[model samples]
Target: MSALPWMQHLIVVPVLLPLLVGALLIPVAQNRHGFKFAASAVSGVLLWLLSLALLGMADGGHWPDGIGVYLASNWAAPFGIALMVDRLSALMLVLTSTIALAALVFGARRWDRVGVHFHSLFQFLLMGLNGAFLTNDLFNLFVFFEVMLAASYGLVLHGYNLRRIQAGMQYVAVNLVASLLFLIGVSLIYGATGTLNIADLTLRVAALGPQDTYLLRIGASVLALAFLTKGAMWPLGFWLPTTYAAASPPVAAMLVLMTKVGVYALLRVWLAVFGDAAGELEGFGLAALSVGGMATLLFGAVGMLASQDGGRMAGYGAIISSGTLLAVLGHSGSAVLASGLYYLIGSTLAMAAFMLLIELTERIRPPGAALLAITMEAFAIEDKPEDPVGVGIPGTLAFLGLSFVACALVISGMPPLSGFVAKFSLFHALLAMPGRVPPATWLLIALMLLAGLAAIIALMRLGVRTFWASGAVTPPRLQISEVLPVGGLVALCVALTLQAGAVFDYLSRTVDGLARSGSYTERVLGEPPVMRPAGGEVAR
Candidate 1:
């Protein structure tokens, strides 16, 4: 049978179906708990299937070009706000759906109590996420972001605790300002270029003279800052740790998908729109990317070292990972892109698992004590399998040991794991580039190495105190439900490491398209001769 054109519906359905499902589950949830779980599970399974279908379609070489949209009522772009999907969009869709499914399944028990509409907000959030990834127009992107962020407000505040409320407020405030900036930036671009269609704007920007180029660059930079805030770049990331820390396990797990949205926007809109055309502008475009990225990485690592809370530390680690991703993007080579993509997959998986694990561990700590301080206060509590409070997960000591060792190997750029491979590819890209590996580059490498060592030592010390300390009492019993999600996530990490070659190959192809402007435009706007940066021909 021939594939139906309605296949495009698969993309929209992942977002829309969940919203509808959530609404359906609301009345039944209060009466039948099993129904709620079933709804979430069915939704998850359907989304996963859809994601797999998307992957197959992308790999089939049949994907369309130039801002694809299957409108709610068959409307077109710039008129009805199209939902576009390129390879980048497809990749993000798969990742977000997978994470959402995993998080939902892992938190099935919790959702049973938190109310059925939890799934509703979750689906609505995913709608926003998928929309953000697929939208081609700037105003639509902002609208999607608000949709997602507003839902996140509910999700983050779900537990109804004072801390959750405070954190949620801070999150709302910071992101609100960032959103305003995003709108302002988009308006400026519209004013300057007289167009908001990304493809058309890209072409017009390319045709501008040097003065107009500066205006475009300024607008682009402002736009990038808004995205940076969303992505948790340093100085703008203060709210992330608190919000993630205070949120419930499922909420925290789902939030991991949000950061990638910023990275994707930067890659899809910022870099794609600028192309080689803006790279040649005198005031450090790609060069600034490297510097900003490295700075963010260092800030994250330093914050991690200073952090005394497990959830907060995980948040910082995520920031570090984001920064590393941005730096990898800056290099703009096949190796670097491959490494960045690999790291993105692995780090996101691990971070989600770790966040859930922190939540579980939190249950075992003293009422006010954080998970990061569990070891320091271990002696106060006795291990009680019956009680839910002050009892850490059984064998968590062992898990913590394993986590420390794995972390050391991964972050230190050691052999055999995904992080090592990614860093190796990135370094190779640096070496292959024309000039020196920039003093800033060297500083980042040094900081990363140091941070890796610090993480190893800190995690080991914490593990030792919690696991083998002479006076410490054992904490509470392990939650079997909790174990499955984190373990599953860790298992994925191992699987990704094993499949590093295949992952790198896919990324290499994607990176090739990104590094060459001609390939990008041809895929998006059809084949055309183009003026490129550094006085070179990007032939189709």
Candidate 2:
């Protein structure tokens, strides 16, 4: 039930590595762009490698009961803070690292030059994301959430355009309110249960009496409001598409990951604190989550269908991703959750790559044609989806067009791609549930199908307009730096498709842990205080 000694040391590196590197970059002179790029790139790659190691450790079951707890400050949980990396968090770390590295490289070509401290803010953002995933308690979660939002505020406005400034203001203001709500909810929960440690909170929830149970529900709902806001769950998520559309491409791509952070926190907290074992409060908010998720799915599909700009459509695509995962999580079906996680990985990579591609493809249109496209889109007029067969620009157009096609196929869940496999797995799990599927779940199924249809129609329309409307346009030049990240992310989707069974098996085991998380309490609280290593070995 315990991890290897070196793995114990490695558990905390994801947080510390980025924290140190971000701080180190702050003092580097602005003109030393190449140096900063090299340092940040190295740090990102290392963080990614460390994440893979942790993923291996977690999936290897070196410590499921322990889940690779680091016991920061060398003391056990509920008495001293703990950082835990399980299969789920490790998976997230890898995804974030992959996306972050892509975004960093994409920006390096041009966007980084638009503003100073871009690289520094980028590292800090990664630190916050990794910390958020690793932290095992409510208090630290809030702290990490703020660190993430703070860096994102700057990144959202990195290029300092009118649209970004306006959108950034809304994004900042909304999250500030969400943070205050988060604090209030945490305070209420702590006041009622006298504990904020998630595993500890689960035990406390099971022991709560009648009055405290009522208070706990109220507190939990308020807390969910905060998370749902950040997770872009409709109504509350009005700020999402506009902000995503306005921000620079690389930042927007990472913002896709950022939205997932909210979903991640929600799922983590919900399962840890309110699992079936939690007496009376078990499955407390499942119905609400299902309903809200369905609504969010509907909204996203509508938004995608209604969208004109590629950026906004990509934003809507992200919202659709959130909605699908939330619905699956809310169903609380173990099989479905595994499939949903698979969907999460595929959709995230597609959207992130799509975000980068938007900026590149925007250049293909000449000034007059670009203006006309905007005007036409403004009026809700679009050309019929055309075949790319006859129209061809050999170099940049081919790459950009193919990337767009791949993104389209994945996002819309069409055949022969990972998206299709993920959705298929999701439905198989949903239908394979032991009892008759509930009416609400049926609704979710319908909505998911329609959502995919909307994506295909909307994205196909957009692609035709961008790639096929022209007869003989000059190909916009693209640097390898910009192209690699987008292509890399799209390639990941291909890998996901090729290795669907293995990936799904891994995620299945990961969610099985969530289904039976009771061991967390036993292992974490009982861990002995860690002592400094002597002569290349840990002393406990």
Candidate 3:
């Protein structure tokens, strides 16, 4: 179209600005902590402002037809990489930036002290994240994904301990394979459709006959597998707990955005490309997706029930939430979009708080002999450091307990919080679906309820151990620095509950954007009725 708007410039700036600052932060990583922090702040502020600008534009119904494409060397789509932000991408942008900023501020405390290049790696990771979320081309998406993973390699191994090294190795290995699958999938799709632009592929993949359906399905499966690895869905997610546990808290919190990218890609590409394929089959993929989603939900709950460690437990909970979202996606009913969006918000918020709580607990517990004496009095041979039994709370532990309660209720889907609101919307969506209710759907509901109960029990056990148990040891007092982060998150959760109506409406609008992929394709591709192929010709 005409010259690119100033706002589109803001989008690319978030991606490139961080990379420049991250590189700059590296050489000064050791000596000038203040400089690193300032660099981080500048990058973080720009990202936040960019996100807010996108949101404002979206609110004003900012659709200017003819694609908002930013091309390097002035090459167009299908030949050159491009960054494109639709309404949904912009929403994710804001959410990712907000969470990253919070986590960076929380994480910098230790990284700044330890001579680590935390600021640099953090910015690099953000660069990867922002680029991945905003890019319109598949190859460009892969590039951004790898860029993010590389930064993760450094962040996960930041401490250089045996645990960090081992965990990072596993994390890198799993994702490397995932990246390969991603590239292979891209190649297959390209070979089949002769285009890598996602919007173009959506128009082409359906034209190939049923004979080629197998290849398309295989391609879709490969891409889904790569994302599943990212989403931490069951059987593919073993690396998440170990790697996240080993990393610093901010790093773990920051990494949460990555899985959502996987989920986002799954939602975006499948709906944009393959959903059109399944349109003729009455949404056949929904059944398979629901089955996998239920399995993941149950798998994660089982892991949570069997584990006592706080960090690992939080990781399992995250997996469970991911499954819940996937399951929502599998429901082909009208409300599925709303349900998926609500659950997405709830799960992200709960997981964020849970990660922070785990870090807080580890920091507050007493070390060594005193810790042992307390455990001995409580009748345990060794201190299960993850569950600190017999500790009395008067200062920091009290506030931590308060946080734990918020985390437990929100995560367990208790009422009056965002989690409950989200789940309620999903359940309502489920029941509203037409035709006979499938056994699998009912099973999912039951499993979700069961998972909620199990998470509640685990969280209760943890709370009693760390906050309420009567024994020999006292918890270290919390500094404002520590409390502020946890307190701020808790406050945010409370606000989420208070503004449930407004948030739910926001979620509804977002889901509307998701469910109607035609509108999205139309907006990006400058065509109305972005339809699938049908009757031996590409459907329009």
Candidate 4:
């Protein structure tokens, strides 16, 4: 049930590495950009490699309990603090580190120079994210959440632009209220259950009497509200597009993973505590999650249509991604949840790449030029030139145009890409369920399709005006550092598409592990429950 002596300590490294590096950078580097960049880049790659090792360990079945629970200072769970790594947490750790590395590399090109402590803030953000994913107890979750939020506030306002400051203020205010709600909810849960450990709560919640069950549900509902706000669900998400658009490209790319953190928390809590094992309290709030997810999708679709700025449109695309994952989670099926996990990875990578691409494509426009004039030039029909053209298209234009097309395909869920495969898998899961498919599922399908259509229309419009219509375009100077990150991310998406079968198999195992909440509960409680045979029981 224990990890190897050497690997046992690696659980804490993902969090400690970033925290120590960020703190060191602040004191040692200060205004030294090169040192800061080198430290962060090295730390990020190390974190990514560590995460992969953890994933391999978890997937390799090296742990007898089917979960890796690390107790701080040898303190036991439900008493002392704990950090747990399972398939889901390990997957998230890898995803966060990969994206963090790419964003750090992209920022190294220029954004790191725009402000002081850029590397410090970035490293702190990684620490928070890694901690949030790894923490096994509710209180530490809140602690890590605050750490991430604090770092994000600094990153959001890094440039100190007027618009960024304004957006940052609003972002700060909203998250502060959410954090307050989070604390209150956690307190209520602990007061009712007499424990703040998630695995402990899983055991306690199942045995609660009717009155305590009511209180637990109330506390959980409040917690869910806080998470939904962070997840940018419909009305609570109004600030997302503006905030994302206002932030610098690399920061915006990093911020895309923040919403996924909210999704991760919700999935962990709901499945571990309030799932079918809750007996009488099973299937709580399913209807609300479904409805809210649909509404968020519709709102994001509308916003995408209304957005004139490419950056803002990309922001709306992120909102749509959140909505899709939430809606799938609401279905509460293992197959659908597995598909959602795959989609989550693909959508996040695509969105991050899109955020980077937006800035690059937008920079192609000449300053102070009107968009209308560019549209006219782009769409103008003309006879073929009498003289043969030396080359079909300029190299810079070709590169930018190809990148834009890839972004458009991924965001809009077009064919032959990871996005399309994710969507197809989701739809297949929904339809494959027994009995009549719910009207809500149909509605989700319709909204998702419409959202894709809207994204296509909006992105095509922006692309045409920015690239095709604009006259005498002078391509922006792009460095290898900047281009490599974007290319790498897009390449990841393509890789995902090609290797989807293997990816889905891993996700299926992950879903199976998660569905056996009792095993997770037993493992964290240190009881080491008997392992069930494959295809035994499935969590509802």
Give candidate 2's TM-score.
0.95
Model 4 is weakest, by summed lDDT over 10 consecutive residues, at: 531-540
Better of 1 and 3 by lDDT: 3
Q: Assess every candidate by TM-score.
A: 0.85, 0.95, 0.89, 0.94
> Which of the two, 3 or 4, has more TM-score?
4
Off by over 4 Å in 2: 1-4, 64-66, 374-392, 531-540
Model 1 local distance difference test score: 0.69
Candidate 2 per-residue lDDT over residues 270-326, each given as its tens digit: 887888778778788977888888889999999999998888998899999999988
Whole-model lDDT, model 4 = 0.86
Question: Who wins the TM-score comparison?
Answer: 2
Could you give me the TM-score of model 1 versus the true structure?
0.85
lDDT of 2: 0.88
Backbone clashes (count) for model 1 = 4
Per residue, candidate 3 scores C-alpha lDDT tens digits across 1-540 of 234455556657878888999988777738777677877977897888888887667655665431345555445555666677766777788878877777767766665455378788888899998888888888888999999999888888886788888888999999999999999888876766678888777667657777566666677678778888998877888888787677777777777667788888877776777654344533546666777778888988888888667777887888888888777777553357766766676667667767866877765555553354446646865534355477444776678777888878888888777778777777777777788887776888898898888888877776655654434446765556566666777787788778878767776676666566566555555522223344544332
- Report the lDDT tens digits of candidate 4 across residue range 273-327: 8787878767677768888888889999999999888778988998999998888
lDDT of each: 0.69, 0.88, 0.74, 0.86
Q: Write the per-residue lDDT of candidate 1 for residues 332-426, one digit (tens) a residue.
A: 52346666777788778777877776655544444433443464455566543344487555576556446545544554446666667767766
